[model samples]
Structures are given as structure tokens and as C-alpha cells.
Target: MELVVNSPLQNQIVGGEEIVSNTSRNFIEANTKQVTLEHLRKDCIIPVFAKDNESTISHYQFVQKTREIAQDLFPEFQVAEPDIRISHLIKGRIPSAIGKPAKELLEHEKTLYYERCAFVMEIPEVVENVNGNNLALTIGGVRAYNQENLFSKKSPEKFKVFIGFKNMVCTNLCISTDGLANQIKVTDVDQLSFAVEGLLQQYDREHHLGLMERMSRYLITEEQFAHFVGKLRMYQFMDKSEQKKLFPVSLNDGQINTVVKNYYSCPNFKRSDDGSINLWKLYNLFTEANKSSYIDNNFERSVNAYELTNNLVNSLQSGARNWFLHN
Candidate 1:
């Protein structure tokens, strides 16, 4: 995917970088002044709230809030309708005999309990790129089911927000990070704007222009890319002396080898004319491989892939920045 270098907000610094250095205590103290929902909505944040006289909100309400928030945030950008997924935990004994009547088994089960809900929205053509490719990011808010299933708890239901970038060319989210930090939880409904602002601030601090500048200027040799791959493998698979187990455990060595072989054989593995690969290309390979290696249908597997890719990209970018600054 190509990098987006000309975003309107590229030059503007919405929040100062120094805020990140302050302790959480100090940061909260400084931002503790009551912020109204109107002000937050102006910042493109739609705070979720229970319906009148109700303590909890329905799944439909959560998804509608996400759609509202995305529309407010990127009016020009194409916002896909939010997809809501609910996971249910079935607690029941397995049928004693094979091919037992499915309906009868369900009758014996006590209940299907709610596990969690994820409200996901796709923002297309957002102005951020990796390796010259246009990238889109997904914003999702998740709420877990509890006893009240509503706002019965004293503290507000903290929706865990995920902000991830998608490769426009490949339509893959393997390289997307959670803005700055992973798993940002929104505890105060009123302070949603501040929470998002803080996340963006942290991202700017960590992924400031210096990193991009270095990527634009430097390229790594094939050997260097190989070394990086080794580092990445160690970072992800190493577990105290052995590689971690691969999914769908039935796969033999030859099957695993074929998957790895095919991945490296892809066109993304090629180097540029300078006899060195651009950091973006190298990073993209990892993300592509991450997407291919995991079981795509499983949400947990997808999340793991995203996290792994995010960490690898962050680490590689940091290393590149250091290499350029010193060398």
C-alpha cells in the first residue's frame, strides 16, 4: 500500500507532545474539568448512554452510536454501516451418542449466556498510508455482558475501543495498530473525546515525523531484512526455548514449510533498484504473512494477528529510527 503524505491534518499539531511525559495523576488533574457531551460530539465522539429510565443499552444502540461517531469524525470519508457480532457461551454437556438429535440436546442446556459484543465500522479512504499505499482504518467499540447487562455498575460500561489501519490495496488489517496503545478503554462516557485525543497524542509522540522521514530516506539490504525477519520470529514465536505451536495442530512439517515458502515467494519479497528493500515493503511482507498465517474466520485469531503485526511494525520502525539517527 502507498503512503499518504498529504493529509490536511499532517501539519497541524492538535495536542502538544509534552502531555505524554506527565504522570497519569498529573494528566488527569490537568484534564479533570468537566467536559460536556456537546463539546465531545463536536470532536466526533458519540458518547454511549442508556435509554431514559434504563441502566443498560441494547446491542443495536451500541452499533448506532458507533455509526454516528464515525460519520461525525469523517464526513467525507465513506463510512460503512457498523457490523455487530455477539458471542454466546453455551454451557451444556455433550450428547452421549454420535449424531444425537440436535434439538433434544439444546433442550437439555440451561441457557446460552452472552459473552461479548463488538461493534465495528469501516472508514474507507482515510488519509494515512504505508509504503505509498492508501490505508483505511477500522474503529470498533466492544462491551462485555455483565450481571446488569446495562449500566447497573457504579462505574460506566467501559467500551474497549480498537483503531486499526487497513491496507487499501490488499484490504488487510494485519499492520494496523491500536492508534498508539492497544486496547484503549473508555470508562467515562463524557470524557470520550479526551480519551481519543490522548490516544492520538500518544501516537504522534511515538510515531512522529522522524520515523516517517527515516523511512523515506533509508532502505535496508536483503541481509538486513533477513535479520529483521529472524528478530521478528523470535519476538513472536519464542517461548523459553522452542517455537510456539501452529494452529490447526494437524499440519505436518511439510505443510508448514509450504506455507512459509509460498509467502516469501510473493512479489512483495522483491527488493527495490537500490539493492535494498524499502522499510515499508519489508514491513508489509510481515503483515501480509501475518494475515495469511492465521485462521481468518476466528475473531481471536484475527486479533492475535493484528497485535503481532502491530508490535512487529512498532519495533521495526523504532529500530529504523535509531539506525538513521545514529548512523
Candidate 2:
């Protein structure tokens, strides 16, 4: 596996049918507005009360802390600017605003804090070629309204962080178990920074790349692909306990439908002439479909995509009881 340092890959992966070049962009992300790190730090309002403390981690602070720790940990690589997507505005009048109430005023006049935000920062200098596409080192975070009560300004704020690869061809993020922390519980910046530092420091890049490399060698025929898709759609309605045993992939019905569609029509990652798809392409399709997810579910699904693919490869190699593959 030859890694091209300083590859032409940039801020986004080349998505859909765009010319597959060194620099690729991503497919459009659903319900997200792309903003710079500076925009979030300077323009976004923080959420807190006058007399009490905050349980919420501001979008800007989360991104900044994660980015800073990542840079400090990987001193050899140059960190690019953070690519942030935010949605679900919490709009209201600021205590200092003098005119009318924010809702009464124009939409632009409100002091707003984003209730949901996700971002990816790539270290372009560290890169490798997988199958034919290039992947760069990428780190990202998700701040969403979830069961974790991520939006509450209480104690024990939670954030989802991941370290992985960004497909140069499109916005597909490649995350593995060694690189993802499903939830980081912290009360302040120091705790958050410590968590990020630990994850980056301990990430197994070689093992992660090995997992992806193994997938490229395995193939699933069209018949198996169809059966697998049908079973997955049904698995969602089954009991939760059953899903944990048979198919634990973290994709929604909408994301699965996108996989079915892309299997037939996607230019870069679709099936082959023999109507068979390799696991590598199959994995990328899951990630491509994941683009339709809102800010909150984005990272969770991305992390799941890689683990699912790696697990599938393990199933093929070891003959495990993964009905998602054999059945």
C-alpha cells in the first residue's frame, strides 16, 4: 500500500459523477450548512444561564478543542482548517439586545446557537491509496441533540469524536473501532482535550488500514447483495435484542435505500460488470448514503459503516454467525 504524501486530496472528497481527480469534493450533506472554524468561533452565540454553569459544549469550542488536540498530537502532519456543518438553530433574543424580541425581529437579527453541529478536519500530508481511491487522515466531532442530552446546559456534556480516513474521491469518512469514541463525557475543556489526546495517541492506523485492505479482496454477488438489503430493511423492525445479535449495523431505512440506489447507479462505487461488488465499494456506498443523514446521526453512522465493513470481512474470513452476510 503506497501512501502519497501531500496527495492532491483537499477539503472534500470528489463525490458522485464528478471527474475522479486528485482533489475530490463530497456529495451534498442533508440539513447542514458548511461554515469555517472562524465563523463558528466569532459569530455563533454560546448557550448558558446567568447564575448557573453550562452542561453544553458550544459548537465552536468543541471543534476548536478537538482540532487543537489533534494538531498537538500529530506534530508531523499539517492540519487543514476544520470543515463544519451546523443545523437546527436555537434562535432567541440576547439579554443585551435593545430593539424587539428576536423572534419578533428579522430572522437575521436573532442571537442564535446551533443545536446540532458536525465537522471533519483532514491532515492531508498523511495519505494512502486504497483500491484506487486515496484516503487522508481525518478527525471529526458531532454535537447533536441525542439521548445523551447533548443539548442540555447541565453537567456531564457529551460529544462524539472519531479519527479515520477521508476518501479523496468523495466525502466518505473511514472510521474504525480503534479510532472512535461513541461518547466522551466531560465537564470542561481540559477533560475534553484529554479525551481527544488519548484517542489520537492510541489510534492504530496500521490495523485500521489492514481492515480496509482486507475488504477489497472480498466480493458479494448481486443476488447476495439483494438478499442482504432486503434482510436489513426488515431487521430494523425486529426486536432490539435480535438486532444486536444478527445485524448490528447502525444505518437507517433511508440510508439502506440509498445503498440500493447507489449499487445500481453510482459511478465510482457501483457494482461491477458481473453484477458483483467488492466489500470496499459496498462500504463506500454505505458512507455515500450516509451523507443524507442530518448533523446528529452523521458521525454515528460513519463510524458504524467502517466497523460493519470490517466485521463483514471478518465474517467472510472466519465463517462467523453474521446473518447479514451468509443469510
Candidate 3:
């Protein structure tokens, strides 16, 4: 019997929902706050509830409950439903007998793990021996800005009451645009857990570290001195580590001069140590190159230097005994 081999395209084909991929593409450019609450409630989260066997409810279980309650309370807001045993729904697979350890389905899954603290309700509420210490109603806070004081004072926003679990306010309703993120006001806690959990999970999953990884590569393989300078300035100025992880590419001499001139024209650049040029700081004058632009000849010298350094490094990684063996 003869066997036929398939082409690379056919052999490597993988199946997945095209709609989900297209949907996630839009999600990539969106920030946490910009994402719609309805998407969080419907697509991302699940609902969870308290059970008779208190021992069965884990901390992660609590977070799931919070999400569901938040969704149920504000159904119109498009919150996620509460999910009990949401961890089980995460979709992971055990390693094959001859292969590696457990493998998660999604490489970039981010989840909120929560623990139960307490439950608060009116006289009709049921009391169960849960792990948490305190429970209270989720009341909206009035945080009005006082111009003279420059600080907002918090007063309870009446007409909204929900349960507090592990210092987290949860509700069985949806949040309108006006509702506070922390304070969930709903009639049913069970429904809120699903919505809240879903939104948070969706946000975490949509935002990956691709930009940071690309930037990191640029830092290690700097081709132009000008690019490094621009990158260094951006790196130093950024407050978040994730944003800084994006490495700047190599820049040419002309690009370096343009950046310098731009800085000189700015008021903030004059007073800052970054703007002033000294011989010691001259080495790092240039920063990243714009990949989309036409290639410049500045990288010729950098290429030669890089080749020499790479040869030495490659030799070291390959277990060359003597330092001068390939010199």
C-alpha cells in the first residue's frame, strides 16, 4: 500500500471560530475601561452561588460569584452572569502519558481568583458558616469633588444595597455607566458573580504582552545609537513597566538630529537632564528607527560591529574553551 503526504498548507491547517478571531482583533486595540460592559456580561463571565456544603466553595469560587451577581443585578448593563465552579470551565487538558505536564488551552488566560469574606442582607437573609469574617450591603458612595478641598468625600448612595464578600462589593444586577466599579448594587448576588467575572477575564485575555516582547528584542539588538537615545527617553518617562518593555529600534544620524532639534524646541526638554548633550551622553544620542521608512546607510558600521560581537557570543554559547580560540 502507498501513502500520500499532504502539502504544508493542508498539513499545518488548524481549526477555530473565525468570528472569535475577528472579534478579538478589535479587542486588541481596546483598553480595559473602553471595553463595553455588555460584552463582559454576555461573552466573558459565568454565574456562581453559595451552596449548602460550605467546604466546596473556594476563593476562586467567590470571585466567580461576584461576577455573576454584578451581571444579574444590572441585566441592562450587559454584565457577566455568576459562575459556580468557573475554574473548571477554564478549559485545560492533562498532558499525554509520554508528554509534558498539564497544558492550558489558551496561553494568555488571565483570571481573577477570589475568596469569600462575608454575606450581609436584611432579616430574611440566610446565614451559613462561610470562611470570611464580615459581610455588608453594597451601597453606592457619593464621591463629589470639592473644588476648594481638592478631594472627594464619600457618602452612601441610597437606593442601592448588595452583599460584600472578602471586602469586594457584589450585586445581582447590572451597572449603568454611573455605577461605581467596586460598589455593586443589585437584588440578587448569584447573578452578579457571572457578569463581573466574565468582564475581568475578557479584559485580561484580550490584552497580551506582544508589544512588550517586541520592544525587549529591540533593546538587545540595538543597531543605531540614535534609536537607543529615543528609546531610553521613552523608557525612562513611562510609569508602567509593561509600556516600557516596548523597545525602540535603531535610528539614523539624520533621525537623531531631528529628535534632538525637536527636544530643543520644547520647554520641558531645556530644564531636563535628558535634553542637554555631553560627551558622556553623546554615545546614546540616537534612538529607534521607523521600520516603515526607507532604509538608511547608517547601519553599515553597526552591522560590522554586530557581526564581530555575534561571532564571539556564538562561540561562547557553543562551548569554545579558550577566549582567543577563534579570535
Candidate 4:
């Protein structure tokens, strides 16, 4: 069985609202390139579907509708420009009997479209300072080519949306289960809007923030950190049945290596002189390491990091015999 986690701060009912988000950003290892909202509305081509298949929601449609919902939900808060990223450019030439050469017409006559996109918009006015790190209220949704099923009109399209605290110091999103809506399937703007509103209303901001505050209070010494790291490194090598008895692993080998490297050198989140790091710092380190993941996997990995770190904090406090955290 997995380690039993108990946190007083969770579900304590100290808040309101939910979060929706799309992708990760920190000027880190994302393959996505920044684009403006206008670009999607004006330049990007919505994918064409086969006769029996219905068209999925366009990138612009999902993002714009979410923006509208955020405004309606939080009318007093100022919403920032949609921070958009797009990738996998698909360009093709339409058949044309050009007077010019084919070589010259190839680049000029091609229609362009992106296969995947995601965006985040910050509500700067709704802010919180947890241990000197400024976290703004952030909402965003992700749309990728893999989520679309163009072969069947009967299949509903899936979209992932999230909202939570955006760590201002490092720009790593602090997401929890209460703030995310993954695989929320909808066919149109109205359905998507309803899903977003439901997600928003379900979030408990005060409780989520309180959990972070609690994490900031617990400290893990460097020795314990090394021990924990060793256990985590061994997790993948363990037999499947044995591994299944505990929590599923979150970081890959490279991400784990990155976490270890950043523990000693991360500018804002490294350990203290006494070789101790608070859980909140460890949480950031996890999110920071998560930057190496692909865009599609980013949202899930981010949530996993939060869950793993929260478990560790509980493990630290309860003196539980967690395989990863205890001897």
C-alpha cells in the first residue's frame, strides 16, 4: 500500500475558486514558441475533418472562451494578455496552376497550421505572498493534436484546463488536485464554458495556499535529502509488484538528476547553510525539474510533483515509514 498521507491544511475550507491552465513556462526547456492571441485567431488554420468526423474545438475558440469565463468569474481582477505557445507547424501547398515556377510558389502558396497549442493568463490583482514568493492567480488551458480524434464524429473532444498559484520568483506553477480539470470533454464553446466555470467554482484557494504555507514550515536536512534521493533512484529498479505497493514514481532519471543538481545550485531555491531545505523549496525544485517534460505531459507531471511533495511533507511530520522518505 502507498504511504498514508494526512495533512491538516487540505480540505480545511479556507478559500474559493478553481484554476485552469495549459502549459509550463520558465524560459526553460519547452519546445513551444511564444505567439500572440491575434496570431491564432488570424493566422492559424483550424484542422479540417473528414466527412463522418466533426471538427474539434479550435485553439482560439477554447482560449477565448476561457478568457471570457475568467472575466465573468472575476470581474474585478485585471487579466493579462494570453501567454500563448504553439508548435509542430504543418504547412501544405494547395494545387494551383501558377504562372511562376513551382519552386517559387511552394513557400508563398502554402497554408499553415499548428498541431498543438497552450496558453496562460495571469490575474495579477489576485495575489498572495507565501514566504516571500509572490504567487499570482493564474488560469490557462492546453490544446494538443494528440487529444483530437478526427476519425469519429461521435467522439467528444478533450481539453485540459488548470488554475493555481504561479510562483513569481521562478514562474513554476503550483497546482493541486482542487485546481485542475483534465480531460474535460466538450463539443462547443458553451459546453467548454460550463466546464471551466464548474472547475473555477470548485477550487478552494485558501486551503490550497495553506498547504503551501505548511510545507514552508517543515525542513528536510541534506542528509535526509540524500537518503530520500537514493530511495527515489532505486524506485524504478524495484520489481513491479514491489513498486506497486507504494506510490507511483513522478520524476524520471533525468528529472531526478536535475532535481539533485538544482538542490545545490538553484538560485532561489537551493538548500540552506546548515544543509536544510524547507518542503516548499523542495516543491519548487520538483516543479523546476519538471520543465524537462514535454508539453503534453507537463500538466500531469506538474500535478504529480505537487502530490509527491505534499506526501513527503506529511511523511516528514508523521514520522511515517514511507519507503521513499524513511529508512
Candidate 5:
């Protein structure tokens, strides 16, 4: 199911104007690195199969224009390389000695231009969804930190856009740090956008909501409460002693007694002073143990119960904070 997205944002009027082109720039970056490693021995060769002068001129012009656009976008990266002589040849089928076909390459360049335009348009939305008003600050901080540390190797930056054709129904987004790639796959842009928006909203809601303080009142430490919550999640889904045996606590001198006392005091924990550990209690205990250590899953369920439990607690805490003031 799609998470959430701005429906009106899609199908908005887009100016049909050419913008910065990164096609050749991306292509060279992708190719050179691989070629340097000898992974791509000779420079990739693709044919230009145009029926007439107009068609052939159009294609060549597009390639040249795209190269110029790319240089403008990334002046540092686009430092002058020997101009690639695009061969003009006619054949029944296009020739591709190095990589994809000629037609494919042209289509790819067009895609790159459009993708950059789309990215510029959606920058606000992406920032709002990822880090809100603090997007620039976060990026700047990360960049500065990366720059300060000489030992830290930097990786090529990757950007992605989700495109949905035919309204919000069919959509996909392709992620590429592959500097060579001109065209990225967009399986369902609308759906992906919706999901991103939804996650952002969900995260926002959780952030506003504070912790389930009432439920956590009796817990000693955050870790203990986290464990308790983990067990609760496990018990809700897991079955019998088989699941029960999975979380054996490695007690130091009197850790079990300490856990028992903590659980007894907690409103959420379901254990009495009699030392009887209920299924709910067991779930939390097991979850905490697994999180503190490791437990192999029986494969009946997908996500780790402990991790989910912690996440749930965090969400709850965030929700609580949103609604109620914590002194």
C-alpha cells in the first residue's frame, strides 16, 4: 500500500523548457572509473542511426548540448576531458561495442535532463519529508564533518526521484550513485512519493507524541523498559515454550530478582510479587534479552521483535511528548 503523498503535486503544469544536462557528465564519470579499473577496456562505442540530415543533426546536437549542460551543472567534476567523437554511421541496427544502444543513449540523455528538472522542482518536498526546515543545516553539518576528517573516505553522491505515470497509480524510483547512468528506472514514482510522504507524516506524528510514561513508570532504566516492551511485542505474536525458551536471561548475582521487582512495579508489565512470569512478561523479557544479545528467528515472523518493540516505544514516547508537556 502507498504510504502518503501530495496528489495535487503530481500533474501540475511543468514548463517544457530544457534545463541543465548531466548526461555526458554522468556517462563519462561512470565509464572512466570502470575503465580505469580495466573493467571497461575500450571506451564504449554506440552508433547513430539517423535516416536523414535533420534527424542526424538533431541527435548530434542533442549529445553536444547535453555535454555542455553537464559541464555547467558540475564544473569541478566536468573538468575538460578529451572531447568524445560521437561516430555518425548508418546501419540497419545500431552498433554498441562498449555499452547500450545509440537510441538508448539518446533517450538516456533526455531522461537525465528531465530528472534534474524534476529534482529541482521537488527539492522543497524532499526536504520537508526528510528533515523539514533543517535540511540545509543537516546537510551542511554532514558535509563539514566529512570535510574535517581526512581519514574518512568520501563516496560519490547519489540522488533519486520517484516518477508516477498516469496520476498516482503506477510509480517507481531509481537510485543511482552510478555517475555513468543517464537514465534511471522509475517503476512507480507516485507510489514511492506517497510512501515517502506517509513515512514523514508518521515520523512527525511520532515525534510530537511523547513516551508512554504511565506504562514505563515502574521500569528502572531505559534499557529495562525497552526490554519489557520488547517482551510484550513478542508475546503478542510468538507462541508457546518454544518461543519462551528462546530468551533465557543471563543473570549476574540477582538480576532476575531485580527484573522481577522492576516488572512488578511497572503498570505495563504483567507479573505479580509471587515471581510468576506471565506470557506478556516473558515476551518483554525475551525481547530485552535478544536485543541485549542475539536470538535466531524461527522464521515464522519477519522483523525482529525486540527492534520493533524499541521502535514502538520510541513512537509512543514521541507521541506522548507531542500531546503532554514533560517537565
Candidate 6:
């Protein structure tokens, strides 16, 4: 079936332009125009494939552009080699012989699909003294695959760029879903570097340092963690208000609690010696949960969870500030 996008933003952007057709069976064809991060969020159309003779950028080019932007922004800091990985979605077929060896059964594997690509580059670590102990600030940019699948009718295959931070002390990576500030979509090769630089500018030294200081000073208490979990549970049962528009479907209470449990039990999420949690830990919990929780194997569901959790964290931060002011 030919997939159709029902987004108003997409219609506005296309504006009666002819969509270039492609021969790839699973690929969706679209115009070869440059789209901003705003366009990606609203339109849900990704311009990954271009028409014949049209210039297109590869994943390697994207990494190079990111490195250039990082160098330009922080000349003193060195951009390390990017750690690259690929995800493969495969369908297993029944083996002809039931008793066949595992190695021989592998030959019967029918199809392997290219799911997505991801890469992370670590920036120069910042050392700070926190209560007579040295803490390292690990900052980097993460590029992950966002694309259309059988379940996702609106969103298309595109790469998403995120600026992430991790304090070695907590070993938790903090990510935000504020596309307007922290995220960007790669549409045009020419605009890739500019888009990355723009995100970096938003998280300038002063802003980044302030957040680091706040996280260092405020240790999350058991009460605060409970409050954050309560907010997530509220999302599960909240009325079909703004959330309905954002999430395709609300997560149930069981699913919410399972995610919370995973956060506390996961070995990767190490708690501080003081037994206090922080925003970084909370943020990592959601991101890690998204990695494992797949709704009917639909990629869109995972993406929605990631975005929802990010917004939740942002709200939690605002609530914390308000509490501090009142007390």
C-alpha cells in the first residue's frame, strides 16, 4: 500500500510540489528540500533519499560535519573519534531440519533489515572539585536514527542529533527532548553543520555550567524521587488533554511501574554513595527504559516514549525550581 502522510505541516511544506518517486520498496519518497528541526517535529517527513542526480549526504559526511562544528565551537577541546554502531531488524524463518545444528540453522535466515545507525563522540572531559572529590563532566553529541516503519505512517527515516552530558560521579547521561533547543533533524547536507552549531550555541558554556552546578549541589531525596514517579503515573491516567495529542496512547500503570523498577535495578544506573538520586539518574532511567520497552515491535512507540519522558523530566525540573522558591 502507498503510505500517505496526513500532517498539515507536511502539506504546507510540499505546497503541491511533486514528490520524487523511489524504487526502494520500504522507502518513502519525498521532495529534496531542506527541512529544519521545527519542520521535522511538525511535518514528520524526513528527506533521507534524494532523486536521481541529486546530491545527498552519507552518514560519514554527517559525522564529519559534527566534528567540524565541535572544533569551531570549542577550539581548545578535542573531539574524539565517534563510536559507531548499526541496528539490524531481522525476521527468522523456520529451519528445514528441526535437529539442525545452530551454525547450520543460521544459513536459513531469510532477511536482514537495516534498522538504524547511531554514533557518539566524547568531548574533552571537564574536571571539577565537588566536596574535595574530583568530578568529571562528560559532554558529547549523539546522533540516532529516526525513521518510518510499517507502524509509523507520519514520521519518516531521518537522523536526530542530541547534545548529551554525563557526570562521571553519577555515570548517568542527561538528555532532553526539547527539539527547539537540544535537537535537530538532518534534512539538507548544507545545513547540517549550521544546525549542529545552533544547538551548541543554545547550550553555551554558561548554560551548561549552570546545569552542572545545580545537579552537583542538589542531591535527589527519596521524597523527590517519589514525586517524580508520581508525575509519571499521573501521565498514565491523565485525561485526554494535551497528552493525547502528544502520545499515540497512554502507558498503563503496570508499564509505568515496570519502567521505574528497571531504573532502580539496572546495573548501568549506579546510585551515588550518599544514596541520593539526581536529574541525571532520572533522565537515564527513561532513556534506558525506552531501549528495552517496545510496543508491538513498533519503533514509533519507542520514539514517543523517549519524547514523553524527556518532557516529563523538563516539567520535573520546573517543579523543582518552583518548590525551591516557595520554601
User: For each candidate, C-alpha RMSD in Å?
Assistant: 16.8, 8.9, 23.5, 11.0, 21.1, 13.9
Best by lDDT: 4
Best by TM-score: 4
- lDDT head-to-head 4 vs 6, winner: 4
> For residues 149-260, could you state the per-residue lDDT of candidate 6 as single tens digits?
3333323224456554433433333443332222345447666777777766665444444443454344466665666567656556667785555434334565566556
- Tens digit of per-residue lDDT, candidate 4, span 236-290: 7899999889887768999999889999999999999998999999999999988
Where's the lowest-lDDT run of ten residues in candidate 1?
25-34
- Model 2, 148-203: lDDT tens per residue? 44334466777888899999888788888779886788878899889888888899
Q: In candidate 2, which residue ranges exceed 4 Å CA deviation?
A: 1-24, 49-56, 96-109, 145-153
- Locate the minimum summed-lDDT window of 10 residues in model 4: 1-10
Report the C-alpha displacement of residue 229, candidate 4, in angstroms: 1.3
- TM-score for each prediction? 0.48, 0.84, 0.19, 0.87, 0.19, 0.51
Q: What would the TM-score be for candidate 2 when compared with the true structure?
A: 0.84
Which digits, one per residue and each the tens of the lDDT, describe model 1 over residues 97-211? 2355434544332222223445456686654655566665666555554423343333444445545655556544432233533333444443554554455334432352234
Decreasing TM-score order of the candidates: 4, 2, 6, 1, 5, 3
Residue 231 accuracy (lDDT) in model 3: 49
By TM-score, the better pick of 1 and 4 is 4
| Decoy 1 TM-score against native | 0.48
Q: What is the TM-score of candidate 5?
A: 0.19
Local lDDT at 195 for model 4: 94
Sorted by lDDT (best first), the order is 4, 2, 6, 1, 3, 5
lDDT for each of the candidates? 0.42, 0.76, 0.27, 0.77, 0.25, 0.43
Q: Which clashing pairs does model 2 show?
A: 13-24, 13-25, 13-170, 14-24, 14-25, 14-169, 14-170, 55-153
